[model samples]
Target: MDHLPPHPGADAAESRVAARADAYAAAPLLGCLLREVARPVTDEPGVHLLPGCGKLLRVRGGRRPAAPEVRTAGGWHRLDHAELVKLVAEELRRHTGLSNHELPAEMADSRDTVAALLTARARATAPADPYLRSEQCLLTGHPHHPAPKARGGGPAATWLPYAPEAHARFPLTLLGVREDAVVEEGDCSALDALGAAPPGYRLLPAHPWQLDLAAAGLAGAFADGRLIRLGTTTCDTWPTAAIRTVYAPERDLFLKFSLDVRITNDIRRLWRHDLRKLIRTDTAVRAAFAALDGPAAWLSDRGYRTADFAFEELAVLVRDGLRGHLVPGATPYLAAGLVEGFDGSPLDGPADPAAWWEAYLGRLVPPVLAAFAGHGVVLEAHLQNCLIACDGDGVPVQALFRDAEGVKLPPGTDRAAGWERLVYCLVVNHLMELAEALAERHPGLDPWPAVRRELARHDLPEIPALLTAPTLPAKTNLLLRWTGADGAAAHYRPLPNPLAGA
Candidate 1:
């Protein structure tokens, strides 16, 4: 057979996809390096000096920076994603005086994962529901993390079917744990509604991906009759931005499971310690939200169920559904999703930018502050943990916070530590990202002033120091990963606070 010539159109399309993936992946990696370690040259625009290597690095664009180049003896050399990863690894080694083979590979894996997701997304149809669409729209996640999309450096085939970015949805793998082996806490009655459990077994729905990942460890339980496969859920559940959590609109329930994969900062497994403290943390948050006089709500992590043998691995948490908490005539969208943006995002083309931003701040800021000041419950109000509900006109009217596992309570966590955490999650992580996105979309919008005013309205003692502080604590994800720090242990670097002068 004669060899056929390669089609120019197809080749060009593939090249475009690769280039886009590179840009998408590079933005977060560059943002992390610049924010966490590099110092900018005051006189040179777009140029930053990597203090570790004493090298000048430059990038193009803000918000989502791109086109990374390093200054060499001969001149400047642009780097592809692979070269960028190598550069980052080398810089980190020099800066931290540590050699880490793992993080560099994760950085590469994250970029490769983006390429795969881009390709998969092109073939898949987007979810019709705007909420689900918003949840799945994060192509470039955690803008300051080195490996936001790294799925344990596994093959795409292993993770893509369950990936939110791919707009993928699948049924939960239903399993039945023997009555004696079943371990549960709090209200897990909603779980029984998923499917029927035979005579002496309790219905335990599991993430299929987790099952595959831990098959070897779970073999003894399966073989010993402690756990048995009971088929799958009748309705498909959409995976949220938090990949391990799945939402079933039909049942109006959220099921969080243990996935033995390193996503961003953690392994994403429901740790035993956190699981044990679920009820206490959730109760504190619930009481705080109930006492507050507003539309802000809390999606309680009602309870969790697991096999006694595989407590952490098989654990699945049941969270309160949306319908009951959301305001009438309002539609809920993930806060992180709003920043990432989707087809129906309210952030897109707002009629009145100032009014829109004010409404958003009104809905989001108060509950977080009240939860801390009034009730001593520090809610993790980071972007991923929050949901904003918009009315028919797409004006934000409500803010709902979830994930009791991330919440901090008094005594156990000192007041000062909890306050610092609240500021980081609510102000630095959540509001700052949203404000940047809004300001980027609408050039004249000065979101910090509204943030300053909204925060000032809150009478908390920390408010004054927060507003005038020269710098704010920003989590150092890149350095954390490089140093192999405990994923839950957060390290921070001071970032110039826009709130200071605003």
Candidate 2:
């Protein structure tokens, strides 16, 4: 090669160093990233007034100045305490924009991880997972056994070779051979089955570092002593659903762009009341609508030394960030996309009147009522909020409660809106979804009885028997499109169930 006057590498390296220096020198950026070496922390005046003392985010300062000192910085800072909070939040938001943008190579995959995440979901009615070892991933696959048989089969019969450090200090399990492939339970497989290698077959759980590439821009712990970029390769645990973008250097997390956020139940009384301000329609009175139509704030409530919510310490490397603890796995948790469900009104059309009732009144009702006494929380028991998830054996074993927002507690017992919203959220809203799902599954089952049983289980104060009820079918018709025969869909079909007493 022709000898250049100077190797470009030297100049490029110098340029990078100078640029970094300039970034630190920038006052606003520097100010936001400043840390308090000795300042006394101060809580918001009214922050302690709120329940759980609305999380106190660490202030970026050498030490929090005294109230008088902070006031002197601007006595108005004291006058507008709420405004200070608002401004800090706004400024903290600006800091999410970092000095540099570097897409990490570790979590990158040619095929999106969403394909494998289909099974990462937690069900309202969870099926018994046989793959999960009783207490540990000890080979022999039993919970307590440390035998090597759990890792017995070779690459053809199984994948994961005997790796001591697989996950949770336990070896990842191989369920069976599928299509000449060693299908590792609760993990990715097809990649290794492509003849990758012998030991390569050992499955790797989601690595925590992936968050640096995945989060909007590592928020927490970035502005402190060291700018630690925390991210989650959210796509790594997902095997289903579509991902629009990981959007590195742009957004922190990957979202199913098409999802509707309104489904999440918001509990703020102000937001709740403001919804029905203009309309008298029942549509204006619903709970799911509030969650779906929200510009909901996604924040980490847990506090840490990090300027922002110390997501680095709290966000699981592999677990779904929001309401993710519901799923169990190693510390290298599986990732579930913080996605919104597509909204088209899951309850808009009824499949079969008799089936709907059979599912609603028969199979689904009895157990849901029992959920209240069993769980200490009367779940919203609404449509779309309950999964009715089944196990490998196709039996309902658990009810995955989606929104704690709509849960019920007897009046004077503690909980806003007490029982009014509770009844609606639980029996009316949540159960409707269960009823619709049940009817779709079994057409012959009577939904009315289950409704009665579910109500009975809850000790309902009143029954629709004497009152002019909204024609049982019409009650559900408003939600579903399926109408039973005779142009009048209010009919009965009993759902099949062997276990009633239980």
Candidate 3:
């Protein structure tokens, strides 16, 4: 809540709000850069030797570090969001010897987007449904990614209307694709029920923003009468934290669209290659969940439909909703939303913190490990990819995982690499963040003991080594972005493992 004194030209309240957002936006970027490109000055408590940027930097707080200051002859000078972006760009330029005008712009756009979202959220009422509120709760997403809120450098007017962070909801743009030009696989009959199509065409739902972006590409299809415009869906779909995916309350189904914007690391488009392999990956995961003993379920990405000529641009993925997959009385909440901190989060109201933590570990950990060890399927069980379904008392009883495109199959993947990813996603990315959130709420209680006990109960061969290991792999998102590495190619650095001695 504390901020440096206001500038002479800036209003006090506005300056404070801007400073708070600047800190929020800069924290993740600074964390990534400092971890990967800078050397820790072990002698100094919060100082780093930033060889890339050619300046020593100091920051307070851990995980999402804040209050960044660069050393100078006069003293340590605090940097605002703009200065921080300049520093980062300079660092990447010096380190890579190449300039990227685009990423720097994206970084600025991300911060500005955060500011706008904060203002909008202040005026708007949060949804009463816990699940919907959770979906709209990600203000500063991907705590370690530099440009988590960046919307491909688009204007606020264009992106804000569809942004989940702003709690925006709109009906899907329905389209009629001629049956002959329609390319589909698996059971996509659920899509047809959304809206009625013409005599010779089938119904296809599209993300409004995506349709706008691909307008140029689809002009020919429309002109040639291969594609026809149908009116919007009668019911509105709620945009999830994953901006491209939407949840239809009336139909109890989820639809994922091929958005062209770059969210997190990659362009948020359903690539043809991933689409081709979707069925195989989803089937494997579905079977694994079915064989598991407990309430853990997999939200299968059942199938997709698209026009043949504009396949990737127009593809829409059909995923199983909460209707059939969820436990009878349990309420499901996105795991990332739990990390992001929402009003009705389970972390907010657990009568017995220790018992609650244990139950959470019990539901979340087993299925991910089982899927990897027994079925040769490595699930991307990160915060956003998984959901924790809790009972009325806010005790977690089940975990539902989604996104077949991110699942990795064994034999095709090296065993060690697969294990590392599973550990990073399930343990480091998912559980560690959740544990931190819990500890923040109840400071005296340590959640790691429960985590250790849960892992010990698992009979996997890797558990012993994991328990004793000094460090766990943490993904280097900033370095990867700076170097222009493929987003899917994960690069990691070691982080101190909390489970090492527990």
Per-residue lDDT tens digits of candidate 3, residues 1-502? Answer: 8888867756865776698789879987886787678888999989988786678989998557889899999999999999999988898899878878878888888898898888788778887789989889998899888888999887888888898998888999999999999999988999999889989999999999999999998998999999999999999998999999999988999999999999989999999999998999999999998889998999999999998999999999999989798899999999999988898898898999999989988999899888887898999999999998999999999989999998999788877899999999999899888888888888898888889999999898889999999999999998788888999998999988999866
Please identify model 2 stretches exceeding 4 Å from their true place. Answer: 1-226, 230-235, 239-376, 391-398, 402-417, 433-446, 462-502
Write candidate 2's Cα lDDT for 1-502 as tens digits.
8776877687875555443322222211112222201122344431211111222322222211122112333333331222333333333334333221111110111001111111121111211222111111111111110110111112211211112112122111111111222222211232233122223222222222223223355342234322322222222221111111111111122111111111111111212222212122222212322332212111111111111232222111111123332223211111010011121212223444454343324333444434433333344444423333222323332333332223343442343333333445444434433443454445555454555544554454433331223422112211111111221222221222212321
* RMSD of candidates 1 onward, in order: 1.4, 24.3, 3.9
Report the Cα lDDT for candidate 3: 0.90
| lDDT (Cα atoms) of all candidates against the true structure | 0.92, 0.25, 0.90
The better candidate by TM-score, 1 or 3, is 1
Arranged by lDDT with the best first, the candidates are: 1, 3, 2
Task: Quote the lDDT for 480 in model 2.
Answer: 14
For candidate 2, give the lDDT of residue 257.
15
Candidate 2 overall lDDT versus native: 0.25
Which of 2 and 3 is the better model by lDDT? 3
- Candidate 3 wrong stretches, greater than 4 Å: 1-14
